[model samples]
Target: MGAGGGASATEGDPFWRRAAWVAVLAAAYFVAGRLSLALAFARLAAPTIWLPAGIAVAAFLLGGPWMWPGVFLGSLFVSAASGRTAWVAVPIAAGNVLEAWLGAWAARRFARGRAAFERPRHIAAFAFLSGAASATVGAVIGAASLCRGSLLSWDGCGATALTWWLADAAGIIVVAPIVILAAMERRDRWNKEKSAEAGLLFASVLLIGWAVLGGAPASRNYPLDFLCLPVILWPAFRFGPAETALTALVLSGAAVGGALRGLGPFSRGNEIETVLLLQSFSAITAAAALAVAAVVAERRKDQEVLQGSRRSLEAAVRERTETLTKTLGELESEIARRGLVETALERRTRELAHSNQELHQFAAVVSHELQEPLRKILTFGDLLKGMAADPRREEWEYAERMEDAARRMQRLVEGILELSRTTGDAPPLGPVDLGEVAREAALDFEPLVAEMGGNLFIGPLPIIGADRAQMRRLFSNLISNAYKFRKKEDAPRIRISAESPQRGFVRILVEDNGIGFEDEFTEMIFKPFGRLHRRADYEGSGLGLAICRRIAMRHGGDITAKGRPGEGAVFAVTLPV
Candidate 1:
């Protein structure tokens, strides 16, 4: 209809393509104008229905505001060809462009453009604003232009303006709807059943129109025009707005032709009066039919949406119900399995507790019995040594050697007993100031450190949660080891410093500048009876570090060591703070 045929005739289109579309639109407009003029009562004025007005409005609505040039050129050509001067034709052309623009703007603003027929309120808006209201623009401008150019007398101007307005309004009401609806997207596809029904409906409307308003004389005078309404409404109810508008256009055309031939009920008066009556009837019928069709369409759409929602909800409920049923079955099975596992675990726990208690008792009994035998041997050996005469004698040397062996045996037994005690049930934890404990351990080593001229530093330490006796023993053993394994040339410089490495834990480091061991012995040194040096060289039961690690672990902490052959060793003990 317009330069772009849709709302795409913007500046972005190629110049040559847009010009081609403009030419097509102008040609269509001029043709429609010439045909509508053939139906006019006056040469320069009153046409019963100006079809070009509807074409111009539809073109603007479909192809956008850029269709103004086509409307202008077409209107100008029609006005000049109808023998009007430039003074009249120019204003008339301008008036036509304004009418098209105003109608399109109002339809888009108040109605929904091509979609206006989908709802009753939008249909009413298009009929009133775009049809009745916008038609006044061209009527007023064209009438004034005719008067100023001396083509129409002042007194006759009112009648010409009224005719112009009514013709344009009728054109929009009857013809614009068909054009717009044709261009719109079809909501319902064509099927054999629907197509047959639509054909039947149109045939029925034509029959009823021909009978009431355009048939033989006997059929027209009985005021049977009211019977035509039901035929128009049939399409509105059975089909949608597009077909409803089409049916109304068909009936209106029939009525107009009958009135022009002076054959229908509206042919009682002059040609102008008969045409006015027919145009009025057509406009009112088309508006009512379109409004009724829109109402039906809207209700149908809402029902469809409601049915879709109900189906989706049912599907979701069914899916969730099935999922929950399977989940409940799995959960019940898991509960039964867990009950059996918990019962077996409780039985194993009881067995383990009994075995640990018996083991502790055996260690205590064995250590006591062994210590008594060693003590008796040492005491008898000492008495025998005293009984010997000379210290250098063979029996005296044998007695001294026996005493030394017995003392070493006693020490080993005591060390084993201490190690067993650490493995037993742990003592209750308390807030122990590790600073005070480290300082106390340092004090215990003071006599040895002073005698050997070695330095022992205890830096600041945090208060922690631990077994007080275990913590004390842990530090003492570490300090004792540092001194025991001192380098021959360098003094044993041992440092005890503490840092909170992370929240809720403190790392107390015991660093020694002494003859450190190899890295391979790091983990082995913490095992029970694990020794990195020969027993004859370093006097230890090889359980000091093992005891230290066990105590740290029982308190939910741990001990780690790093060392080189000559560099200092650092033993980091992490305790909860």
Candidate 2:
């Protein structure tokens, strides 16, 4: 039986549990001692015979190291009180003490988590090794006691030594293993699901019971000898030799009892080979059981590993399916984008052709209107040139101004027509490096900004799809306005910044240190011919800003401005991402 983790729990466990076990052992020792005595009086007449009944088994099994006192003292009392040679007592006591010590030492040394009497390699190595070693000490002391007192011959002492070995081996094997097997089978806890124990315990009850019954028929005088075989084999498979020795003790007692009473058919010599054969049977059975258990455990481990690999493969398939779903979504979006671009191109081409036709009609109407105005201006100027010695010289000057107004109107009309047609067929959207566009535009206006003693700061920029020439125009127009409007003696500072809020869009900002305007004029500035300052003060056609707004709308973007009087103005331009 094997167990791990923690001590198995029971009611009032640990301290009380240990106390209960020790008390039970103490009670069993005394009771078994008394019973052996009563049984002895009914048979052998010597009480010393009762000494083997429980004292040896108790000392070897429960007492651990402390069993020496009970075994040795108990033996001293039993041997002296019995009919053995009066002087043989002390020597026997020494042998018992030595045997107890060896059992304790082996328990502390080789015993593992398996029950105390669990099966070790050899019962002799288990029993006789420690038993033989510690018992040798007792035998030597006994021999010395016999030699000094002259109570027995050297050969007789030698025979007594052999008898002592028999008794000790008997107690350690027959009784020890059975008690340990019972205790182990009593244990319900296990490391596995507990099949190993089920097989062993089931076989233990069957084989050992058979041995007890069959041994009786084999030697009617010592039929108990059959019981010794199962007791020994049980320890080999279910327990170690400490318990085996205990099993051995009960068998020895029974064998000796049956032989002394003339109840068995066998003579003493027949029992020797019987002893050797039991060991052989135990050795083979123990070896086979252990080998089978090892193979089963190994096979179980392999099956678990294969199952884990199958689970991992299933998870990888799920991840691959998710990746394919995302790819399909992107494919769908691409198809929709190309479809929209085709519809927009067809619609825009028709609008452009119609606008061009209207422009031609507008030019003709403007040309006709301008001819009459120019003729009137000429007639007035000619009248003024012919007014010789006239009192109104200021009137002649006013007529000259009329001709100037007509020439300016003609130039404005031409400029308006040019603005409508320019940049109408700009290239399709593509990845445009906005930073490169800003730098090139800045360089073109470098000479002008230097002349005006202005500073231009280009902030962070991002790239997007846009026409490069149109971007250059947008930047040039904003910078020109800022430079021209700078406060007297104040440096013009232009800062350009761009942001990409999404993958396909960009926003560019142009801010300047110049003479700013009021917020009320914001909408007015976008209208044609709308100007905050007189044309005499700023040489502009007032159409530059209106055309800038139109170009921004055509690109699917827009421009707006915010300013505080006497401070500065900032123009925010947003383009499609």
Candidate 3:
């Protein structure tokens, strides 16, 4: 076999491995035979019975097809050295060769991944039966052919065959799994990580039981949950199942060894006792191992479910918290806007009030000082009218002059007072029935509406938080204007309704189809004394919006207008709920 290629050893190297195996097999047989003879010489030649076991174990460890010739040759050498004629030794030699060959065949075909003595059933299946057959066949054939001098009868041959089979089987079951396990134990694979610890723990249950505790307790008739089984399961649970399974097998073999070696009460005796003990031990241990596996697997499953639940709950809480925080931020921004609007309104109100105060003071002064002079002019005009003979022209001219001068001062006083009285002592927050207010406003304008051939319709409304007087006045002003500004060519229609969309506010809308103005004048029309139409076309103090806007501001709300030219205009007033 060309089994070499410098750095990369060729596939042929396994031939060398096979050759080395043969050599070791031959040497072990020869040495064991010599040792057996020495033992035979020492104890007055009584068979102490460890010799055949040595023969079988050596062959089991090193035997293969190529090792057959080596074992046969080694057996021949043992006969030559023993000083016993071929008649006494050649049959033993042939039996050894046959047993070794059979073991090697079984191992090559079946024991690649398994340890020596890995299963009692496997031993019962191949190791025992194969060895028994090899030993019986070789012994009967070799004894008949070469042992013509010994007193070997059928009974003696059968006893010897049974003994040989037992010896061979003991070696195979006790030793092969261990050797196979060693071969499988790569340092890189079997390092003492958690898995390794688990393996060692499992294997140690048998080893330690054999070394320390000796064997299964004499009192146990069936499998009980052993302390060691749980210990093995702990690592098996944490590390993995493969390590645990392998370890369990190792321990099982150990348990068998302990039972067979006669160190405990449960040690092998008759064939029946030996088989039952082995069967029971293997079945119980395997069942316990399986039970541990089931529990550990379930624990891992539960852990995964719990971990998923925790993640889902945390995600839900995080999402809910984020939504709540966003809503709070929006509310805070709205509050800030309200505060800004209130500040601006306060400033503007103060300015308007101050201007009105100044105008009122000036009007008071004018009223006291200018009115007496106007009265005296009227008196002189009357006197002139009485004194003139041609009275129609003189009286008409004097009266017209007096009336024009006095009317200018009266207009100034009234305009000043009306603007000043805009905020005539309003009440604070209270419950206002908006339905009642709308009805009252509609009633106030009903007579005017009939006169103008216009209609005002009120819709459903809700009770809201507000100043009752202010709300009533506000509705009344809007209805009065709706009827007051009817077009000559078309019938005026007004619709009023209330709706609450905002959680914190109520909205009341007054819609109308009338002689609507351009939208550009919408903002300008809300100022004090601001008018969109000429006085000849429509008459008003133009303070309607100013009052509406003031009321809305007082309630922390607003009024907005949306419309198209000549279609209709809608006034939306939002009041805090």
* Highest lDDT model number: 1
lDDT of 2: 0.55
Q: Which digits, one per residue and each the tens of the lDDT, describe model 2 over residues 224-333? A: 53444554555434533333344344444444444434343222344433332332232232233223222332344466577777777777777777777787778788
lDDT of each: 0.83, 0.55, 0.57
> Regarding TM-score, does 2 or 3 come out ahead?
2
Top TM-score hit: 1
Candidate 1 local lDDT, residue 373: 83
Candidate 1 TM-score versus the reference: 0.60
Compose the digit string of candidate 3's lDDT tens values, residues 1-577.
1111122222244877666655655676567556544422131111212233334433444333444655676777776774657776666666666665666555545543133233334434444444334445544544453335454554355544444344344334333333333434332344558566745675666655555324655534533335455645654566443344445545544544555455443455554344344434443443344345446655766787899999999999999999999999999999999999999999999998787667756655665566577667667766766666464685667676676555554444443343334444345777878988889878867776667677777888888888887888778777766666556677788899988868988889988886666878788867877877875577565776777777777678888877666767788899888
User: Under the 3 Å rule for N, CA and C atoms, how many clashes does model 2 have?
Assistant: 42
Task: Sort the predicted structures by TM-score, highest score first.
Answer: 1, 2, 3
| Each candidate's clash count | 1, 42, 7
For each candidate, give its TM-score against the true structure.
0.60, 0.46, 0.45
Instruction: Put down candidate 1 lDDT per residue, 375-484, tens digits, no spaces.
Output: 89988988888889689999999999898888877877887888888888878889899889877877878788877888898898888878888889899999999988
Task: List ranges where model 2 is wrong by over 4 Å.
Answer: 1-67, 80-91, 110-119, 122-125, 142-154, 178-186, 189-266, 269-426, 429-532, 539-577
Clashes of 1: 1
- The order by descending lDDT is 1, 3, 2
By TM-score, is 1 or 2 better? 1
